[model samples]
Target: MKIAIVGTRGIPNHYGGFEQFADFLSQGLVQKGHDITVYSSKNHPYKESDYNGVKILHKYDPEDKIGTAGQFIYDLLCMADARKRGFDIIYLLGYTSSSVWQRILIKKSIVVTNMDGLEWMRSKYSKQVQRFLKYAEKLATKYSDHLVADSIGIQSYLKKTYNAESFYIPYGSHVFSEPNKEDLIAYGVTAYNYDILIARFEPENNIEMILEAFSKSSTSRKLLLIGNFKHTDFGIRMARLYGEDTRICFLGPIYNQVALNNLRYFSNLYYHGHSVGGTNPSLLEAMGSSSLICYHNNDFNRTIVGNDGFPFDNYNGLKEIIEGKRKEDFFHFLTENIEKIKNIYSWQRIVDRYEDYFLSIIPKS
Candidate 1:
């Protein structure tokens, strides 16, 4: 099958979730002998045309100069290019800026869109932008041949709200087996002695709330934050408010996958405060890394973690959990999560699911 993937920045995964998905999924498909072409941004560091047997098509991305509005242009460029390619499947990763131009998508290709989290619910966007995102969601639903929801909650919402059926295929992660205690030395932390929270320093991610909760706790353990917090206004404010605390360490964004996995594996507690996303990749990664997880209490999160994690709704709840009794052993939760990673959310399993789904929809020639 000739597949073209659109809607992410690029393949080498310089960015977040969707890029990582594209990187892993495209390579996996290629391994299965499928012809895959991933649309990458011109700005991506990877200048090569091919990555690990997968074809990379670099399109002009003006987001750096024109800001967020540039994404619409970038999407348009990708869609225009895709229309000319005789692809069996044109997978749209998200609908944020591309759905508005859905009319231009190739009619011969079976258009399948991954309906990301409810962007309208994000606190970072203004009311006007939220309205636009809602409209985009509608466009994406109406125009695409099929829809994919990364979480059960998202699937249910699509059915309830749009009366539309969607495939529930969550994100995937690899279990971290190589745990090096030396990896912790560079970060100035010891194994299983510090707590960590990795997320974008955005309002909806509950970054400040998690930091506050950690601050309120009396434990001498360090609270290490991993994200780009210096750029945004809210993040700057958070830095000022919590910077004075000696125990809180603001470790900026670390994109290296092995480093991140090592951090999660060695951390005492991994905090996921992302309340808006569906089947978040980071959450899956924490599980795969065998971190004793504490996630934001929501359907999207609960669907993945199930009974294997500590759920916290607010700072007070999280603070109590932090200060509460320590378990003699957290082997049960850790083992259960690891098993889930191996059985359900592993990269191989996820790739197989995607392949089966695609084959089911696209008739054999």
Candidate 2:
């Protein structure tokens, strides 16, 4: 099958969730004997090379910032190209301008879009952007042949809000092996005696609350917060507030897989403060790393970790976890369910599910 993937900043996945998902799925599908071509931004720094067996087609965009106008222009170009190229399936990751245009341009294309999260609910966007997203989302669901929800939470949202039936396929984790002594030394950590929280510093992520809770705790364990500090004002403030603290280490963004895996694997516990969105990549990675999970949102976290892990909405509740009162339950949950999570959320399993879904969409000869 000839498949075209639309709606990402392009790959090697240095960015966020959708890029990573596209990279993994395209590579895995290509390996499984499908002809896969991913539509990437021409600005992405990769040569026009075959990743594994998949082809990378770089589409040029006029605008620099990836806001509404820029994405609209990008999608218009992609839609025009996709209509001419004639692929078996066109998979859209986000409900951006590109996705909306693709649906209009390539009516015959078997469109499958993954509604990543409730974008309208996110705190980052303005009222106008949120209204635009709501419209874009409606168009995406109405026109697409299939909708892929990354979590049950998202699946429920789609069904309840849009009355859209979606395929529930969660994101996979890239688990890393234990880091060496040299790797630890490179990060300036004497030992891996710390808790880790890796997320983009945003208002919805509740980074400030987590920092305050961790700072107030008398625990010997340190808190390592990793993310891009230059992306937003929230990140900048977080860097200024926690960067100098001895107990809290703001490691900025570490893109290296080996270093990231080392930090994840060696952590005593993994903290997820994201109150919005479906299943998070960082949380899945932590589960795959066998790290004890502590999360901010009860509804979504409980879906993943059950009652074994700790779920805290406030700083005080988070402090209780740091004080060691909830350590045993979190650890017990990790030990008991880590294997199950590994089996279910592994990339191989996830890719297989995707393959089945893709094959189901293909028409019979």
Candidate 3:
């Protein structure tokens, strides 16, 4: 099958969850002998025409210069280019800017969209933008031949809200071993001596609330926040508010997977505050790396973790967990979570599901 993946900054993933997913999924599909072509930004650091058996096509991406609005242009350009190609399927990772382009989307492909999360629910966007997002979600749903929900919560929401049904396929994870304690020295921290929160600095992620909870936390273990602190207002504000705390360290964005895996593997606890997303990549990675998860209480998070990790309703609840009694059998839960990665959320399993769906939905002539 000839497949084209769109709606991401593109492979080799210098970005977030969707890009990483695209990289892994496209490469994995290629390994299965499928013809895979991924659309990339013109300014993407990697200029290679192919990587890991997948073809790379570049379109004009002025995201850096024009900000959020530029992404619309990029998606439009990708869809325009895609119409000329005879792809069997065009897999869209997200529907943020592409949904409205439904009418213009390539005619040669079956569109399968991954409905990421309830974008309209995020507090960061204005009322106007949220309204558009709600409409966008509907348009995207209307245009897609199939929908993929990364979590049960998302699948339920889609059905309940729009009467849309979606295939449930959660994100994958890479299991890490007992970490190298020496790796902590490079970051000026020690193994098992700190707790970590790795997420984008956004209102939906509850960065400020987490920082506030840590500010009043009685535990001696440091709070290491790994994110692009300067990227958004929430991040900048949180950095300013919590930067003075000797126990809180904002290490900025650390893209090195080895360092990140080691950090999570050795950490005392991992805080996952993403309140909007379904099957967050970081959350899965943390679970796989044996980081005792301290997750925000939500259907999305709870469905994935079950009773395996501690849950928090708010900053106060999170603080209580931090200051309260520790779970005696946490090791067992950590091990179970890694097993969940290997069995359910592995990339191979996800790719298999996608391939099956694509084959099933191919237009019958």
Candidate 4:
């Protein structure tokens, strides 16, 4: 099988979820004796032509140069190349940019899109941008040959809204066990000593609410926030809001997987405040590391975490969990989460499923 993965920064996953999925899925498919090509942004730090046996194609991404408008140009350029290449399948990771070119995508290849989270419903986008995103969702649905829902919640939305049938394939994780203790030294916290939270510092992610709860709590455990704190106004304000508190440590973006896994592996508690997203990669990572998760209560999150993890809505809810008594069932929650990753959410299983799906839908030529 030959596959072209479009609409992402590309392999080695320097970006977020989709990038990570592309890196893992492409490499996994290659190992299974499939030909794989991944489109990467020109600005990606990994300047190599190949990554882990998969071919890499660089597309001009002017996000740094022209901001959000550059993504539209980049997706167009990628799809144009994809249409010409004639791969067995063109897998699109998201629809925000690619849906604009839906007419050209028809009959090019078996185009499958992962209908990620409720993008149009996010509060961060202006009403106008949200309307356009909704249109993009419709356009993407109209053109794609198949759809994948990362969570059951997403699957339900696709059905209820568009009456579309989508394959359910949640994100996977690697069970990280061995971590070098030295990785946590520079961060000035011991293993299982600090509470950790990682998010984009956006409104939809509920970073403000998490920070508010953490601030109000009088816990001895330190709070470690991992993200590009200087990227947005909310982040800057959050930093300054809690800057004076010595207990809150604003550790900037740590992309290194080993170091990140160490943080999750050693965390006494992990907070996932993202109110929007489908089977978030970070949550999977926490589960893979067997870190106890405190996720925001939502259908998307609940489906992934099940009853094995904690859930909360507002600061008051989270504050009580943070400062209040640790449930006797918490240990059982940890065990179940570990079992969930091993059995249901392993990356190998996910990769195999993706291959099966692609093969099942490939035109009988």
Number of backbone collisions per candidate, in order?
Answer: 0, 1, 0, 0
Off by over 4 Å in 3: 325-329
List TM-score per model, in order: 0.98, 0.93, 0.97, 0.97
What would the per-residue lDDT of candidate 4 be over residues 129-186, giving only the tens digit for each residue?
9999999999888889999999999899899999999999999888887878799998
Per-residue lDDT, model 2, residue 230, is: 79
Off by over 4 Å in 2: 63-68, 325-331
lDDT of 1 by residue, 139-210 (tens): 999999999999999999999999999998999999999998888888999887888999988998888888
lDDT of 2 at 66: 58
Clashing pairs in 3: none
User: In model 4, where is the ten-residue run with the lowest total lDDT?
Assistant: 324-333
CA-only RMSD, every prediction: 1.1, 2.1, 1.5, 1.4
**Considering summed lDDT, which 10 consecutive residues are worst modelled in model 1?**
322-331
**Which candidate number would show the highest lDDT if scored against the true structure?**
1
> Measured by C-alpha RMSD in angstroms, how accurate is candidate 2?
2.1
Top candidate by TM-score: 1
lDDT of 3 by residue, 111-169 (tens): 88999999889988999999999999999888988899999999999999889989988
- lDDT ranking, high to low: 1, 4, 3, 2
lDDT of 3 at 25: 90
User: After aligning candidate 3 to the native by TM-score, how far in Å is the CA of 281 from where it should be?
Assistant: 0.5
Candidate 4 versus the native: TM-score?
A: 0.97
Better structure of 1 and 3 per TM-score: 1
